[model samples]
Target: MTMLEERPLDEPFAADPATARRQAATSPETADRPRSISSRTFDDRMSLGGSAVASLCLVWLLYTVVLPMSGKLGFVLLWFVAFVLLYAGVTAVSQPGPVVRDRIASAVIQGGAAVVLLVLVFTVAYTFVRGFPAYRHLNFFTQDMSSAGPSDPLTQGGIKHAVVGSLIELGIAVLIALPLGLTTAVFMTEIGGRFGRIVRTIVESMTALPDLVAGLFIYAFLLIALGQERNGFAAAVALSITMLPIIARSADVVLRIVPGGLREASLALGASHWRTVWSVVLPTARPGLATALILGMARGIGETAPVLIVSQPSAYFESNPFHNPMNSLPLFAYTGIRAPDTNSHTRGFGAACVLLATVIVLFVVIRILARQRRARDARPRPWTRLARRASS
Candidate 1:
């Protein structure tokens, strides 16, 4: 105290300005800068504005540049960029104090990256809006591709054959893959030992194998066994193999996430492990299993490589699975690309749009079913009270 007083008195004690300000604003003993109200407000507002602008710029860029130009890769990139920018902006805006300012520039950079994504989505949408009007009719869905010729501009060729082929193949593949995949998943999740681990590793690795490889494997195996060439049945087998790995992995993950407590409770009640798994575990995981099946079906339906390798193209409709080559939506698109006229091109685009629509419809149906199931489970049960009464 004595030394401080002496030092201060030397200059008439004008008071070290920073020290005085700090003492008045916050801690009397600590040395720090006192920020004015206007300065703090300005900094905060500037940061918020920058963040907003950055977010908007990112969205704008994505819609304008990347979507229409990039195909599948572009679509994925746009989604990633859009989500990242949006999350960054939200985080920046919600953060407390000075740290909020730091994220603004980062937001700007991310936003810039999103510009290409914006362009891509917009271009695709624009193309759809323009071309969709040409094929948006019931005639497109109800007719077969057989009646139309290469020179016919407005003739009545329908997607019926292609639709039938797609549905049949998809159905067969789903029927074959679901049970096999579900069984494999159950084994991997419930069974223990080195054997289970090996099986799981093999399933996981199969998920990464190319569709063409799966097609070739099936083609070679069947060709050797039955001494026959590729056909619709062959295509279905290939699709099943390709889809099985994905379904198994997804279902395994879902089952593994189930709580051990549930399993223990079922077993403690004298339920066999197999019974508990089938009744309790599977019922609980039904939604995930359905989702996996849907994904498998979708993948198999759109697979061009396996279909191309195993099934020959058909200009005419063939209802018999074994007698003739099956013409699917994917194969139809492939054929259209090689056709030497405007009619073929139009049909290709229309078929593509329909295929895309079908995938979307399946996804929507799954979502609706999931929601309904969830709602049913969420509702209070009159049956529970009835059961309690009966027991008592």
Candidate 2:
């Protein structure tokens, strides 16, 4: 047989299964046509379609199909939606099989989402920037809010009393919530048993309790205990009730993320558990703890219902927390909203902008400090060495 006439060895052991299959699949007339392209496309489309159907079913099952059996339906729906989206994303990435078109499509989708998000952010920023300066003058924070009628623009009072009251009440609220929440978190994370379960249940229940319910509970209970009328202190206490559980749960989660190995190491060194927790775990989780507190405060700071029930809004500054119905930023916004003048509404918007900015700035500052602290901790122990040398 001639070398060209005889089948090549490569043909017998061809690496391309499709090529081999094509040769086997076709008669002499049909050998020119391809087979794999349509088959692969069909497989890809089938996989993607199956994924899409499954994803849709998952989304629907949680959101539309299922009845709310537990109070946690929102959380379950959240997870279900996340899972569906993730599955869809995986399917999209895998089915396309590294094609340049898929990459381009992904980029375009991402860019569109980014553009939309940027537009929303810029719109918010523009409104705040424009409205903020309307009341950003020095007098805005300095003058008394007393008897400033809507018609009198020049005599319109500053937010001095409200600002001071807010700061004082917030300070008191933080002092109350921080320790209680931190201790609760420590207990939840460090202790185990049926007690842990109970604590967790209590925290979770507290988390789900309505803010107005909390306000009413505190207003009834604490007001009776203290034998006092509604005042700034009562408002602070009400705010603390809503804030504490959140801080505890969040801090507990953060503390749980601390490596058990760290605690074990400290224990192995003959350190007391309490000491180890205080010196090691607390420090490690400090950033997250700070973030949690800041978040809790942010949640409570804008609260109107609780304050309205527990504290009366006053125009003049009052240093006595127990006797005086103090002016608060939220109360100021409320009055401005209900007032008849456009100027008052503008002022309210300005205050709202300030309040929003304050919360955002605190969150950002918390994150920045956390990062800086982590970096500082990560730095070489040169300072320790220097301290040791000095001691020697």
Find the candidate with the highest TM-score and give its number: 1
The TM-scores of all predictions, comma-separated, are: 0.72, 0.68
TM-score attained by model 2: 0.68
Q: Kindly list the per-residue Cα lDDT of model 1 for residues 1-392, writing each as its tens digit.
A: 58666685433332665444334444443336544433445545565566556655675566666544545656555555565555555544434344444454654576566777888778656546643633776666787767767666544776688888888888888889999999999999999579999999999999998999988887778766776665677888889999999999999999999889878866766667897787668877878888888888888888989988878777677666666778898888777758888667667767777787788899899878987886776677685553443233
Off by over 4 Å in 1: 1-134, 378-392
RMSD to native, candidate 2: 10.5
Give the runs in model 2 whose Cα sits over 4 Å from its true position. Answer: 1-123, 126-130, 379-392
Q: Give model 2's clash tally.
A: 0
lDDT of 2: 0.75
In terms of lDDT, model 1 sits at: 0.74
Error of 1 at 249 (Å): 0.4
By TM-score, how accurate is candidate 1?
Answer: 0.72
